[model samples]
Target: MLRIKKLDIFVLKSFLLLFCGTFFICLFIFMMQFLWRYVDELVGKGLDMNVLAQFFFYSGLTLIPISLPLAILLAALMTFGNFGERYELLSMKAAGIPLLRIMASVVIFSIFLGGMSFFFQNVIGPKAQKQLWTLLVSMKQKSPEVDIPEGVFYSDIEGYNIYVKKKDKDTGMLKDVLIYNFSDGFENAHIVWAEEGKLELTADKQHLYLHLYNGEQFENLKSQSVISQNVPYRRETFKEKHTLIKFDSEFNMVDGSFLDRRSDIKNMREISVAIDSLIAYGDSVGRAMHAETMQLTYKPAQLSSSDSIKLQKEHITVVNVDSVYNSMTSAEKLKTVTATKNRLSSLASDWNMKSYITQNTDSDIRSHQSDWHKKITLSLACVIFFFIGAPLGAIIRKGGLGMPVVISIIIFLIYYIVDSGATRIAKSGGMNIILGTWMSTIVLAPLGAFFTYKSNKDSAVFNADMYIMFFRKLFGIRISRHMFKKEVIIHNPTYKEDWEVLEDICNSCEQYARTHRLLGLPNYIQIFTNNKHDDVIKDINQKMENTIEDLSNTKDHIILNYMNNYPFLSTTAHKSLFDNRWLNLLVGIVIPAGLLVYLHIWRYRIRLDKDLKTIIKTSRDIQEQIKNQHLY
Candidate 1:
C-alpha cells in the first residue's frame, strides 16, 4: 500500500537541502533581531563565556517557531521557483504529470515539518523561553565592568563617587584621585583627597581596595539637633592609608522562579490548566464585584425582622429629599452635605479599586487565552506558509535568492504586520482571541488557494499582458505600432496580396463604423443589457496584424513606413462596460456609474472613428506605393 517512488524521493531531496540551509539562515536572522532587542541588557555587563553560550542556545530555541515559518516560505518559494525557472516544471507537466502530483511530496514533507514545529513549540520552546527571560533579567541586574574614565566621575558603585584626574595604565597608578565617600548618608558625607592612589579588587572580588599616598581626609559630623548645627569637622593628613569600598564583582545567577509563573514559559497542558484556573478566578472576581455593587442598591439587613416582613409585603416607598433638605437649618444642611460627599468619595474609591482589580484579572485571563491559541496558530503557520510559497514560486517562475527573497520578505512582512496588529487588538479585548491569533493564516489562505489553482491549470497568474490590457481598457490608453525595417528579408512581402487584405480591412472598418454609429452617443440601455464584440473590428484588427507581419519584411522604405502608421485596434474596450451582461446592467441602472462608463466608451468611440480613418489613410498610402512598382 505504501511506496517511495523515484520522483517523490527526488523532490524530497531537493527541498530538504534547501530547507535545512534556509532554516539556519532564517534562525540566525531572527536570533539577531531578538538579541538586538536585549542588547542594552547584555552590553557592559561582565558575563562569562558559558553564560553567554546558554543565552545563545536558549534564544535560538525560543526563536525556532518564528524562524521555521519564514524558512519554509523562503525554501518552498526557491525550490519550486528553481524548478519552474529551469523548465523542469514544464517538463513534468509535459510528461502528463499534474502540478499537484509533482508537489505532493513537498506538501507531505511540509506537513511533517509543521508537526516538528508544533512539538518543538509545545515541548522545548517553553523551557527555553523561561531560561532566556531569566538570563536577560539576570543580565539587566548585573553590575557593569569597572573601567573608570580619566576625567569623569564614576558613580556606578552603590554610595561612593570616584573622580580620577589622571591614571597610569602601564603601572596601574592614579596621579590625582578625588573620592567622595557618602556611604554614611549624604548629610554626614566625608571627602578624601589623594595625591596618588592604586586600586585593586580583593581576592574575593567583593571589595575595592584603595592604597593612597600623601592624602588628606575631611569629615563633617552632622547632627539633627539645632544647637549642634554648628558642626565640628575633622581633617587628617596621612602618608600611607588604605580604604576598603564594598563592591561585589562576581557574577551571580538570579533566581528565575518568578518567570515560571509566566504564560510563555508554560507547555500546552500547563497553559490550559492556568487558563482554566484564571478564568474561574476572573469569574469569581466578577461575581464578587457584582455583589458589592448590589449591596449599595439593596440592604435587607438594615431592616428589622418585622420591618423586613412588612417591606416584603409592600416593596413601595416615596420620599421627598428636596423638601427634607429645605426644612433643615443651614448648619444641619452643611453637616448633611459634608457627610453625603464623604460617603460618595469613599464609595467611588472602593469602586475604582474594585474596577482595577477586575481589569487586571481579565487581562491575565486574556494573556493565557492568547498563549493557548498561539501554539496552534504558530504550528499552523508552517503549513500555511508552505502552501503560499510553493504555489507562488510556480506562478512567479523566478529562481535564486534575488526575486524569491524579495517576494518572501514582502509576503512575510504583510503576515507579520497583520498577525501582530490582530494579536494586539485581541489581547486588548478589541477582537476575538481565536480570530486574532489566526488572522494572518485566514488572510493568506485564499491567496495560497488562488495561486495553487492557477499553477495547476498552467495559468500565467502574473502575466503582464493581462494586467496591461485591463488598465488600457479602463483608462482608454492608446496602442501604437512600432514597425522597424529588417536588413535581411527571408520572405519578402507579396505586395499585391497584402493590398487586398489591407483594402478589405479598410472597407470593413468603414462599414462597421457607419453601422455602429461611431459618431453618435452609445445606447445606454443596450450597452448594459447587451454585450457583444464588434466582429468587424476583430476581423479588421486580425487582418491588419497578419498583413503587417508580411509587410514588415518589405524592401520598400516607404511601404515599411506606411505599415507603422496603422493603429492597433481593440474589439471590446469601447463596447459594453464588460463581457458580463449582469454587471453591465447593474452599472447601467446606477445612473452615475453608467454615466462614467458611458463617457469613457464615448471617448474610445471617437478614438476608434479616428483610428478607422488613419487605417484607411495608411492603407491607401501603401496601395498607391505598391501600384507605382517601387519593389519587385
Candidate 2:
C-alpha cells in the first residue's frame, strides 16, 4: 500500500487545477482552429442549434488528443514557474526535498494523462471523427437560404437568375423582379417581369412557390428541333401569376459510408490486421513482378523458332556481346539497337507501373503504421512535454500567463513542426515510421533531462551576467577601469618615485612592442597552434599599476587625474585559442574557422600595439605633471 504524502497531494492539486483550466483552453483553441477549416461549410447554410451544438461537441472530442500534450506542457510550465517565482521552490529545496521528488506527483499525473490520451484517441476519437466529418459533408451539401438582394441577380438557384430592384425586409416582399429562366436551354430561354412578388418554400420544402402580381411572361415558342424562317416567341400578360420551381430547402443527414476512414477508424488490433493484409498484398505484387521480369529475355528475330526453342531449353556457350555487336552490318546494328531500346523501354514502363502499385501499397502501410504509432507517441509526448515544461519553468523562474504562455507556444510549435514534418516524411517512405513518429519526442527528452539536471543542481542556467563574465574571462576581454579622487590622505604621493616607475612601464612597453612586432598580423597557422601568453606584457601591466597606485594619492588634481589614462590590460589575449592542444590543432586545420579566430587575435594584437603607444605618451605626460607639482 502506498501512503499519501501531503507534498504529493499539494503538488497534484496545484498541477491538476491548472491542468484542467489549461486543457479546456487548449481544447477550445484547437476546436476553433478545426472550425475555421470547415467554416465555409457551416456558414450561411442556416444549420439548426442542435447541429451546431453537435458540431462543437464532436469536434471538441476529436481534438482532445491534440490538446492533451500542449495542455500538459503549459500547465507544467505555469505550475513550476509559479513555485519558482513565489520562492516556494527555493524553500522546498532548502527543506531537502529534491526537484525530481517535488515533480514526482505531476510526472505520474502526466503519465496518466498520456495513457488517457491514447485510450481516447483509439476509442472515442474515431467515433467523433466520423460523426464530425459526416456532419461536415452534410452541411456542405445543404443549400443556403434565399436572401435575394436589391439590384443584384442571385444565381444560386438552379436554372434561373433573379434580379430584384427592391426588397422589403419586414414583409419579405420583392418589387420589380426580373427572372431569367434557362431551364430548358440557354437558346430557348424564358423571362418573367413582376411588379411585386413573394417566394416561399412548399409543404415538403422540396419546391419553391412564387406569387407575382401584375406579371408578364415571355418565352421562345420555337423548339430546337424546329427550323422556322422566323424565330417566334410567346408573350402572356396576367394580373396575377403563381409558379412552382424545383428546389429542396430541407436538411437531410447523409450516410457517410463513402468516407475513407479505414485506418483512422481502427483500434490497434484492427490496424494490425489491416497492416498484415497490406503487407501480404505488397509481397504478392513483388513476387508476381519478380516472376514476370525473370521471364523477359532478349531474343533475335533472325533466330529460327527451332533455334530459339533449342536455346531456351539448353545451355549455350557465353557469347561476347561486344564481338556480336561488331559483327553486325550497319542496318542490322541499327535494327538490333532499336529493337533493344523498344524492348527495354517497354520493360521500364511496365516495371514503373508495377513499382507504382507496390510503392502506393508501401505508402498505405506506412500510413497505417504511422497511425498505429501515433497513439503511443502522443501519449509519450504528454509525459515528455511535462518534463520539459516543469524543469524549464523552474529554470526561468517566471510565473503567470505572461512568460509561461510565450515559452509554451514556442516549445509547442517546435514540437508540432518536427512531429508533423517527420510523420510526413515517414508516411512518404522517406524514413522509418517508428523513428519519424518518435523523432520530436526523442529530440525534446534530452532537453528536459538537461533542464531537470540544471534545475535540481541550482545552476544559474539563465543568468546572463554569469555567461557574460564567463565569455569575457575565456576570451581575455578587457573591462573598463573606474578610479575616483580620495579625500583622506592616509598615504601621500611618492611623485618622484612614481615618475620613475612610469618610465620603467614605458621602457618595458617599447621593448615588448619591439620583440613581438605587435603592429604586424600573426601567422594563421600559429594563431591557434603556437599561441602563448606574453609575460613581458604582464610585467609591463604590473609596472603601470604600481605607478598609477602611487600617483592616485597626489594632492595636485592634474597629477592625480593624469593617472586615469592608464590602460586596463588583459594578460592572455594572445594565448591559446581554447586553452587545449587538441582543440587548437583542430581549429588550425579548418581554414574558414581558423580565419575567424585569426581575425579576432589580430584585432587584439592591434589593440595591444595601440596600448603600447598610449603607455609611452601617458607616462611622459604624468612625468611632466609630477615635475611641475614637485611633490617628491
Q: Top model by lDDT, which number?
A: 1
Per-residue CA lDDT of candidate 2, range 1-632, in tens?
76679989988999999989999999999988888988876788778999899989998888899899899999999999999999999999999999999998888888888889998989998778788878888888888888888888999889999999998999999999999999888878889999999999899989899999998999887653446667778999989999899988777889988765457777888889999999999999999877776665444346778967776788765556798799989999999899999988997998889889999899889989998998888888988898889998999999789989999999999999999999999889889899998899889989888888898898888888899999987666657655667888798877767778878888888888888866687877676776466678888888888777766776777765666776788667765677787898898889888788778778788888888898899889888877776656
Q: What is the lDDT for 496 in model 2?
A: 68
After superposition, which runs of candidate 1 have C-alpha atoms over 4 Å from their true positions? 222-230, 300-319, 323-334, 484-517, 529-553, 578-583, 630-632
Error of 1 at 513 (Å): 5.2
Q: How many residue pairs clash in model 2?
A: 0
Residue 473 of model 1: what lDDT?
A: 64
Which 10-residue span in candidate 1 carries the lowest summed lDDT? Answer: 221-230
By TM-score, the best candidate is 1
Point out where model 2 deviates above 4 Å: 1-3, 182-189, 220-231, 260-262, 284-360, 466-479, 484-511, 521-533, 539-564, 578-599, 613-632
Per-model TM-score, in order, reads 0.91, 0.80
Per-residue CA lDDT of candidate 1, range 1-632, in tens? 76888988988898899999999999999989988998886787788999899999999999898998899999999999999999988898899999899888988888888888888888999988988888888888888777888999999888989899998999989988898988987767789998999988999989999899999999885645435647777899999999898888777778989886688989889998988887888789888888977887796435468956775678746435697699999999999899999999998998888888888877777788888888888888888888889988888989899999999999999999999999999989999988998898899888888888888987887899989988886776768777778878899888779988878977887787677778788777777888887777887888988998998988788887888788878777678978888999889889988899888888888888988999999998998898898553
Q: Report lDDT per candidate.
A: 0.86, 0.85
